[model samples]
Structure formats: C-alpha cells, structure tokens
Target: MRVRRCRESDVTTQIDAHQHYWDPARDDYGWLTPDLAALYRRFGPADLAPLRERAGVSRTVVVQAAATVDETRYLLALARDEASIAGVVGWVPMLLPDTPALIGELAAQPKFKGVRPMLQDLPDDNWIANPELAPAVDALIAHDLTFDALIFARHVAPLEIFATRFPKLRIVVDHGAKPSVRDGAAGWQPWADGIERLARLPNVHCKVSGLATEASHDWTEATLQPYVAHLLASFGAGRLMWGSDWPVLNLNGDYLQWHAVASELLGALPDAQRDAIFGANAAAFYRL
Candidate 1:
C-alpha cells in the first residue's frame, strides 16, 4: 500500500491529544526502569517543543505517566509555564476517602482537564466498574472534567459497564484499549467488538495513539490499517482524536513516523473529518 506522507501544512491547528513528559529522577514512575534504555531518561517540554514544532502540532495534552498526585501537580506546573501544553490529564487516587477533595483541588487548576487511573497496570479488570469509586467519578462529572481510561483489551467490558453507570462522565479510551496489534490479524476480534460497544455510548471517546508500542517491532502503516479502520468506523472522526504517545513512541518509531502513518490511514477521510481527528475534536473534547 502506498502511504500518504503527512505534510505539516495539512492541518492549521494540529493538537496532539495524548503525550507524556516525565523525569525518572522524580522516583515516582515505577515503570521507568534503566533496562528500557530508550525511555529511562527524562523527557520534558524542551525535548518535545522541537518535535511538536516540526509536526505542526500547536498544542498538546500531557498525560500522567506516574500515578501520584504530585506528578499531576508537576505536569500542571509545566502547563502553566509552557504555552504548547494545552491541558494536563493528571493522576489521583480514586478509591481513597479524600478523592473528592483531591479532585476539587486539582480541578481548580485551569489546565487540569481530567484524570487517568492507569487502568492497564491494575490487577483487577473490573477495577473501574467498582461502585465504591462513585464519589471520585461523580466529582469528575460535577467539575465537568474528562476521564482517560488507560486500559487493556480485557478491561473493555468493565469499561462499558462503568460508562453505562456514569453516563454523564466524559471518558476517552486511551490507545483503543491498547489492542494486541503484535498478534496481527488474529488480534482483531474481541478488541474490535469491545470498542464498538464502548462507542455506542455517547460519552466515550478513543485516541489514535500508542499503537506503535503495541505492535510488532517492524510495524508498518499496513500493519496498523485494520485497527485504525475499525476505530474510524466505530467512533467516527468526531469522537476519535489523534495523539503522539511520544518519547515512549521512540521505543518503536518517532513522532514524524507515527504522524505520517496516521495521516496515511486517515488520508481517505474528508478534509473536515481529517481535521477533526488531527486537531479540532481534541481541542473541543479537552476544551483546549
């Protein structure tokens, strides 16, 4: 398949819906070990500024890579000083008794647009569905904040139940539930069906990010087409947003490579629809 190269001029207001900036020295990122040399070091706004500039991404939503409230505060502080960081999806202990208070404090920050619980790392697949977390979830809706579900395929059914339970809470499924793209064609099943179900709910959205890390080491545009197609068909451009997944993306590819692949996958879309996935939808969804 001939892939379309993404030109920087294609979208006037490109926004990277998902990305991360972390300093391992902070000691909170448990997953940032030295063995994974590609991503073990610090990645800050200084590193991303050039890449974003080259990609024509005007603004970005920096997500929480660490699960601590301090890290959330860290990102919020970064957003305050960095004009390109449009929003910050920080972390909070949802099940704690004082979660509502924490949410209130975090939401007070203008750039704290949402919370992500890092559902993929949890042992329980149904963790998000626990009614015990209602207070935290309710606080999110009450404050008009969004939820970014960092989940795996197994968590999809539970996510559906969670979304149904809190219909008013705006949720965006990060990385399309991190599909088993490494398995190639055989990986498409339940993941695709599960995403389709989530899309049926009006409050749920999905990001076109992080697939490179989930795919085979030598992944190409063709390797990702079917999955991207399913997302486009399932959520439509209005609910599907583009994300860089950056530095971690360096594990498999670079920002420009993923951007070009995404452009090719979405090349057939109408200009308006393409623009929505590339920028407009995320800006509206995160209120950037």
Candidate 2:
C-alpha cells in the first residue's frame, strides 16, 4: 500500500487520542515489573512532541497507564501546565467505596477529561461485573467524564456487559480492541466477535492505534488488514479516530511509518471519511 505524498501544508489537523505519558523518576511506574522492563524507559510530553508535530496532530489526550490514583493526579497537574496536552485520561480505583465522591473532586480539574480502568490487567473475567465498580463506572457518567476502555479482545464479554450496563457513559475502545496481529491475525475470530458486539453499543467509539505493534514486529499494512478493515467497516469513519500510540509504537513503527500506513488506509476512503478518521471524530467524541 502506498500513501499519496502531500505537502505538510495541505494536510489538516489530527489528534493522538490513545497516547500516554510517564516520568518514572518523578512518578511511580512500579507497574512496569521486570517482566516488562524494556518499557521502563522515560516517556513523557518531550518524547511525543516530535511525533505530534510530524503527524500534524496539534492536540493530544494523555491517558494513564500506571495503576495508581496518584497517576491520575499527576497527569491532571501536567495537563494544566501543557497546552499541547489538550486533555488527560487518568485512572481512579473505581471499585472502591468512595469512587463517586473522589471522582467529583477530580472532575473539577479542567484537563481531567476522562477515566480508564486497568481492564487489561485484571485476572478475573467478571471484574467489571463487580457491584462496587458499577457505580464507580457510573460516576464517570454522572460527572460527564469520558470512559476509555483498555481491555483485550478476550475480555469482550465482560466489556459488552459494562457498555450495556452503562449506556449513558461515552466509551471509547482503545487499540482496535487489541487485535493480535503479531499472531498473524492469530486471534481474529474472537476479537472480531467481541468488536462486533461492542460496536452494537451506539454510545461506544473506537480509536485506531497500536495496530503496528499487535502485528508481527515486521508487519506491513497487509499483515494488519483483517483487523483494520473490520474497524473501518464496523465503526465506519464516523465512530473511528486515529492515534499514533507514539513512543510505545516505536517498538513497532515510527511516527512517519504510522502516518504513512494510516494515511494509506484512509486515503483509500472518501475525503470526508478520512477527515472524520483523522480528527473530526475525536474532536467531537472527547469534546477536545
């Protein structure tokens, strides 16, 4: 696949909705156990700055990856200091009793635009089913906060229940529901089954990021076809958005490669649709 070369001036704006930030020294990332030590490198706004500029993405929403409440507080504080960071999606231990009240306190911060539970890290399939987490999930809805899901495809059943249970919450699925492209479309059936179910929820949206990493380390656009095509077909341009997943995506592809590959996929679509995939959908979805 080839992307038509265009002058940077001809390209319009875009946003990296699924990007993340962390200052290991200034903050805690003990979550990066030695098992995932390679990911322990420093990554913050400085690392993303060039990727954002290169891809013509003026604004970005930095979400939490750390498993701590202080991580949320840290990003909210960072958002206040950075203009390029238009929004922040931090974590809150929603299963706890005071979740609703605590979220009420966090929402007053202008940049605290959304919340994400560490769904991928859960050991139980019914974690979202917990009665305690229900109101906590609802707390985000009550405060008009966006909910960004970090679940893998295998956990789709529970994800479906959560989305259905809280129809009022504006949910965005990250990483194309995390297709196992590395497995050479190894997990397509299950991921697709879950994605289709998740798509049925009109309130839920999806962001196209982290695809390169999911595929084989040496993946091409063709390697990512099954998942990418399904996303476009499932969510269409209106419900889909784009993100670089940056420094992390560096493990798979650089910003320019991601830019080229993503543009190749979208350029094949109608101009209006490409606009929506690139930025319009995210701007509207996150109210950025």
Candidate 3:
C-alpha cells in the first residue's frame, strides 16, 4: 500500500463523501476500458492527497470502483493507512446467504463504514427491491451500515420500494441519481420527480456530486445549477452532502473546480446550512 502525508484533522475537516481508486494492474476494472482513456490509468491514495489538500477536504469516503472483494479489500487497506480516507464504502455479495457474515467480517475493521453494490451496471433495474436480498439489507441495518445507492434515474422507482421496506436503514443517493443532463430540459421532470419522491422518505440523503460529467462536455455552473437546485430543494441541507468525486471528476473537471462549483451553488444558504451540505451531513451519515 502507498502512503502519503495527509492533512491534520485539526487544520481541515471538510469531508469528501464519495471518490474512488482503481489500479488496472491489480484488478480488472471492466467499466474502465480503453474507451475511457482519461480514467483508464491507475489512481490511488497518493494521487489524491494533494488534490484533497488543494480542495481543503481533510477526509473522504473511498467508494468501491469494482464489484470484486479484492477491490473492497484494497480500499479497506487504503482507509487503514491513509488518514485522508476516513471511511470506506466497500462492495459485498448482497444476494448471497453468507452476506451477513461477510458484512460482519468487513465491519470488524474500524474504518469500514458501509457497502455499495454496482447497481447501475446490473441488468435488472429493480434489483434493489428484490425480496431475496432482504437478508443483506437486514444485516446492514443490524450492523448500522450505510448503503450508497449508485443508481440512475430509472432505478428510482425500485429505490422507493427498497427504502420503504427498510425504513430504518441509512442510505445516501450517489450522484443525484445521475440525471440525463445530455438531454437538457427534456430529461429533467422524470429525474426530478423521482428525486422528490425519494426525498419524501426520511431516511434517504442526496450527494451533490458527479453532475458535471452528466452534462455536455462544455458544462458550466449555469448548466448544472438547475439539477443542483432541484437536489437542494428536494433533500434540503440537513439531508444533503457534497463530494469531490476526485479522479472520476477528472473526466469532466477536477477536484478544486467541482468544489468551487459546489461552493458557488450553495453560496446563498446560511453558513450553517452550507457547512452541513459540505461536510457535516456526510460525517453524520457515514458516522465518520
């Protein structure tokens, strides 16, 4: 594992709620094929610490970039060694009978905070609502683990059902359900409606991250404001948090650029509310 100097917690406490690390040499990142040249190269904690310092983000939740346990283990090791990575959202075989035991084993680590399945990549859109997966959901609730929903707009309907069944479970929606920014206004209503419905559930939270990548290549603050505004209105500051999305943000933008956009978008709110959206809410949700 590569270790780097990290920010002292006393000096900075902004938490980046979502980011990822991947090394093709170590694991096969199927989604990160040659077509994604910008993100195809290796990314690890060493590459991120400087960006974190530049953004004034002292800690982060390193999410799984691949579905394999090896990838999760890799992230756990980073969380173990990298002070900037406060917690980890690792992957687990949710449908398997041994999932509870597996979750227990992972959670035994002090930095293991949650689990996130590659839901968007799965063929079935309604997989989150599958009754057969109840045991795993129960395990998460029993262990006080969080669920990072890496879903798309189409998955919102089933997510509502899943939230209803597990009302007490903590869940933070990753990337604002990844709206159809490419379609512009034509794609707003469905995603907005789904987000609003999900927000009605008291347990769900939303992350203001990854929108620039969804928009056109030349996206601007004005281009992303509507989606950001909708998320703020739907989830409120208390239930919303900000994330840099790090190297993934490199596809469309960079850490400081995304952080600046977030600051500009939330500039209107009171400092307390902005503070919650930027870091406090994430700390509370992931129990960092």
Per-residue CA lDDT of model 1 for 1-288, tens digit only, reads 342445655676899999999999999999999999999988999998877877678899999999899999999998999999999999999999999999999889899999999998998888988999899999999999999999877888889899999999989999888999999778887898888898999999999999999998989998999899999999988999999899889998888889888988898888888889999999899988
User: In model 3, what lDDT does residue 123 have?
Assistant: 97
Provide the TM-score for each candidate, comma-separated. 0.96, 0.92, 0.94
Cα shift from native, residue 236, model 3 (Å): 0.3
Better of 1 and 2 by TM-score: 1
The lDDT for every candidate, in the order shown, is 0.90, 0.79, 0.86
Steric collisions counted per model: 0, 3, 0
Alpha-carbon RMSD, candidate 3: 4.3
Which candidate tops TM-score? 1
Residues 47-77, candidate 2: write the lDDT tens digits: 7787677667788888887878888888888
Model 1 bad stretches (over 4 Å): 1-9
lDDT of 2 at 173: 92
What is the C-alpha lDDT profile of model 3 across 87-171, one tens digit per residue?
Answer: 9999999999999999989989888999989899999998899999899988898888999999888998999999999999999
Q: What is the lDDT of residue 213 in candidate 1?
A: 91
